[model samples]
Target chain A: MISSLTQAERGAAMLITLSGMVAGLAMAAAGRGDPMGAHGWIVLAFFALFFGLLVRAAYETEAPEDRSLAYYDDPTKVGILIALAWAVIAMGMGLWVAAQLAWPDLRFDAAWSGFGRLRPVHTSGVIFGFGGNALIATSFHIMQRTSRARMPGQVAPWFVLFGFNLFCLIAASGYLMGVTQSKEYAEPEWYADIWLVVVWVVYFVLYIRTLARRREPHIYVANWYYLAFILVVAVLHIVNNLAVPASWTGAKSYSAFSGVQDAMTQWWYGHNAVAFFLTSGFLGMLYYFLPKRAGRPIYSYRLSILSFWGITFFYIWAGSHHLHYTALPHWVQTLGMTFSVMLLVPSWASAGNALMTLNGAWRKVRDDATLRFMMVAAVFYGLSTFEGSFMAIRPVNGLSHYTDWTIGHVHAGAMGWVALITFGAIYALVPGLWRRETIYSWKAVEWHFWLALAGTVIYVFAMWNSGIIQGLMWRTYGESGTLLYSFTDSLVAMHPYYVARAFGGLLFVTGAIIGAWNVVMTIRHVPRQIPAQDRPTTPKTMEPALPAAE
Target chain B: MEISHELFVGFSKSFGLFYLIALSVGITLYAFWPSLAGRFDKAAKSILDDEDGPCR
Candidate 1:
């Protein structure tokens, strides 16, 4: 069975096994005493060995000449599954942490289970793992199809995919083990950060080379957005993660930045991670899938180009808005706030472009769950971006910052826009990648849509009201000029809202489960009987294997 | 090389902002450039041209 794969597949399989062996050895050395470490090595050993065997077991096949003509890849297939799996985990983590806040006893006395540790897991898991994989999978699919050319080489995409996921593993496991720099979103210690840097560089090179191979006259506007996302994210990851490790094993590290510089650096990394990682990449998905699904032309092709450059230029400087009223220079804070406000222009441009593109396609939007997901995602994109700019102003930040209001804002974007759009992209891709007519069940897609909608609405509104009440309570004063309400009073008030938020999260995860079911069933339905008639003699044996008649 | 710190900062603050604004405006104009309307229209519908079959 192993003999059927191309030379590249076999080479990749062997490389994966060797890397696992090296990981296992490293784990034995570093985790010499810790079960977590020992367990990590053992898992790597098994994972590598299993994949090696699986690759070896794959039935060998010779590709027909027509197969290489247009480049579509299965890395995307693996990517969407990883994205859904991460969504389930990250949403679960979000729910657990929210519960812990409502009832502190939920920590269960395990240090790793404590809110402090798991919070990073929730953030990193959703942002990098879930969002990152969706971007990777969709970008590869788009690049190949839009360019009308194969990726320059095959193994690089897999290397970037697996390598990035490996870094996600290191980051998550390290956080639980108390190995972190404690920098908001850049929490992974120096080693994990470095590994990500390497993976990101490979991703960038692969993108550029693929674009270089494009037969299309103009690199579709979608590829441009995806490319900008790759390029900007690479720069941000490297600069923000510059750190000195205490040991060679990379379990701990110190930032190259310090004092206000460190704070600024961290938030710069934090916000742009939102910008480039979440916004930019997903916008790439929107550009392609929204138009394709809406059965409409992009409302304005030029607007996309303008918005792309506008966002790329302005977003880099807006990170300092997270540092308002800090020790950072007043001028810098003002500059950050200015850029943050200006960002609304391009953001709306992108959002409006998408919404306008759906102008004539509202009937399709009504009928198609996948298109509805994209359309609603566009609306949330507009809504959250408007809110983001409002919060950046120090006066507004004064009330909203350090409250569940901020949490609500983040989730509105994360849950509403990011996850929703990813589902849309995956829904569009699943049938195409597997060469099926459509999903196994549009009924499930409809279920996911409403469940996700109800959850987001409940989660966000509950937080908004709770946050405003908490902020108002914290500031209430008596005639005696003494504070009228203690912090605990606000906590007591927030109790019910916390419960609602947790319940909202439960709904979110349930929707994701439905989505996962939809994805798996769709893939399973794609016919796979072609290899048995492996002898390629025009259409003699192949004709009957085709699912066209179905 | 001999520029004062304030001068350098001022230059960056003013020139950089202006350059970006100009570039953004330029791209927007170019996109809506009347002559390019047909090209943009075709590009918008490019996903459907000459496909092997219905991708449905």
Candidate 2:
């Protein structure tokens, strides 16, 4: 009976199972006196019925007439749309909360609206919600296209999608309620972390399974990077999040390490999160999309492979750069700084290859806003990597460590590199997946391009100005051998730059909104009817050709 | 020294350094080897084999 159903129906049933179990857990956790218990039981019962109906629906639906027609699964299309929704939510909150720096008067009476809580919501939401979903969705899409195999199957893919989002949901709600584990980028509590582990392991298996089924003799370059991303993230997440729960039922947990050891573990995880999550996965995207859009292969396959291993091996050592001025040993800090400097070579190898792929296609780069987004993203990748290497130097880090300069550097990377490449890849993928002939509006793409460019410029400038000013003011010594400026004096001086930073953020949010609208319209678009001149000409004769002229 | 952060940091000075250098050199040699060029080329082209031209 189950064999009679389609993959889509099976996917729907899997969602039912996932939701039902989660609802059951919520009800169990609620206990008797909890105010949410009534609501929990209701949701649980709803899921139970929903599960039954989904199963019934699956049994009734007919399987596809041709097995070959459904070779690739498409949960990615749904994942992409949801990723856009998250990007909007994440950036919207980011702008609102950031504006509060200039107008701290925007403060709300509610605890959830506090800048402290909203900051995590913005970080995690963008990194995980926006960026994570894009990585998963694009990885699934690129994995299938490269491997020439169906997705690992219907139910498992849905499990990954639904389960990962469940983790995101728990994380967001938990933060609002003040239930974090207090580790930046690793803040989700023990249960959420464990659930992410399960979801990620399944994702790894699914990727390996797809590769094993490939029609080609060799796995592609993109798959190698994607695999590194998945495996290393799992390692990083588990090692960084080792903690003992205060109790079985409560959301509180304590890290396994304390003092300087804890700080070391956190930065190791933090900087590498930038390494793996921000860099590696998007390098996978860059490998696929840039070449495909430019209608050329990467300039040097050898460089990519060398760089791939180079980045993976070196990024692990560079995390201690985040701990330079801290209690971490001088030798350890030197090791990190040295490897970080070494990293620039490999990082640029990939970034340079992306640009070189477009070498003969400069005309295409000029004309296409999509390609321009990608090209600029590569340039920023090169620029930011160079910046990171120098910034890791002890003297440079000493001056820049805790200033808004660090914020400037981060936005250069986050706004400039990570977000741009993701945007470029999305623009390329949407039309292909949505079965549209072109974007619903190229005008919107152009608008998005300028808006994002302007926003990033304004943001970087404002932060750089404010950060350098803050650093110099704080360090300035009076001729009397006394500190020149009070700490509050720096804050007073920073208000204008804060307002400018907020303005930049608003502009970025606007660009993202425009991008979201363009994508939505494109997805809803019907394929245009090609006019006679526009359509490819068909051969007039229907005569069968003789086989070989025999 | 015990098997601890202190011990590990001490060990990392030489052992960790050599391990990474070795890994980098090994990967570089493997990537640039003459015999594997054809395989790399095939992998590069694999993403294009099933293309139906971007639904456009």
Candidate 3:
């Protein structure tokens, strides 16, 4: 990675690394005898390790090659590897958490290993660690390809990738250290949030700089979604994390908003994090990789534009649906519900656009495990979005809210749509990125696909069953007009389902491990040969004469 | 004029509703504009022929 950089960029990297080390040292000194101090030591070690590498590489002579002749794929390559690593680690944490629930005594005798702490570790690890890394890596690949322009700077992409991972590291570690802001998704405290803002701004700037130099006059639809993902996520992160640290050196902080206002802001940030972070960014992947792999153009370009705008507009208002029947204003809740229901139009439109793009490619979908992953992802995207809209209605929310139903719904989207699409994209990208003819083993790909599908189906079904039963049991009335079942009774009833859920999670994690192994084997064994016509080209000024379809 | 809750709700109930409706219509129209269809189609197919390396 260091060998690819010009001497100037290497010098800049050293300077940045040095500054990061100093900051970490300062934090370590200031927050002594605290968890923040431990985090500071971690940060120092992290940058220090990088600094050591940078120093060792500093002696090497730089190669004189035109940097713009190839896409900056080193960061993307590293980012994908890091993402797969996090998928194994974090999804393994997910399985552990699930097991802990089924067998409550399954944890170690330590505060860090407790359910409350490890739960967020599992969450932030998967969401921000695995999912976030995938988005960043894929975005880098997609943005460059779609624009047909090289990334404006070499150092900035590295900065964004590593810097973002630093933030993820701090987040996952903080959760284990019992440090949090106690918010659902925005749990990372003030310092980590601030660090992410710095990283995110650089990411945004990198995107815009590349786009500004695009050879294509028309920005593709994928770039639009990616831009939205970056831009809106920054807004959400900053607004939701508006907090005052109890001490400048400590991890503890107080939120700017109070009570219902805090609830509203949190969910707004929370749900939109889902919208922009999970859905939109992955949708960007879906747009680019799905069609590219199928060797087909999008079915309706106009529908793509329509759905893009529709989702952008509708999803913002839909966050309040999470606040339904809460202390939040009834009207606001209704507004959220209304927009969430309206959101289905664009959601389905995009899903339909994807499926319709596969019209003549049905054979590919049938035969190719990678394509089937994407196909099933689109179906799940449609399914979960419909379920989301249905659940947002107040009466439905009354049953689904605080139940495992919400968990089922989220995983249906996360595992089914987001994770599946990511795996599909990764499989589609791997051989190409590595300059291999094809994957090392097609059988492994097929195995991973079926394993992932079975795991997701089993997990979702178990959650749905447990959720509805729990929701019903809670509301059930005896003849004496009392609750029919105690909470313990419900817990007892849920034991079997919990075991099933954990078993399903174990299967999912096993599939991810297999996928990771396959990736490694492919990289190791596959012979290197660049595909023909796989190089970027200069823009053609002359407009092509074509026959209009409509 | 002072911005009060009453004023905000009343304005939103009337003007906000109309404005959103208008905006939605405008976006829909912009997406479906007959002349722009070809441009959109071009955008869709533009990246299909992308190569792995940057322009030399």
lDDT of 3 by residue, A198-287 (tens): 999999999987777677768999989999999999999999999999998788999999999899999999989999999999999999
Error of 2 at A297 (Å): 0.6
Docking class of 1: acceptable
Instruction: For model 2 chain A, give the 10-residue run with minimal summed lDDT.
Output: A532-541
Residues A155-201 of candidate 1 have per-residue lDDT tens digits of 67777887788888877887787767888888876656766888889
Q: How accurate is candidate 1 locally (lDDT)?
A: 0.81
What does DockQ come to for candidate 3? 0.61
- Pick out the ten consecutive residues of candidate 1 chain A with the lowest summed lDDT: A530-539
In lDDT terms, which candidate is top? 3
Ranking by lDDT: 3, 1, 2
Tens-digit lDDT track of model 2 for A370-420: 988999899989988998998999988888888888888888888888888
Which is superior by TM-score, 2 or 3?
A: 3
Clashing pairs in 3: A534-B52, A536-B53
* Model 1: residue A382 alpha-carbon error in angstroms: 0.5
TM-score of each model, in listed order: 0.91, 0.90, 0.96
Clashes in model 1: which pairs?
Answer: A4-A60
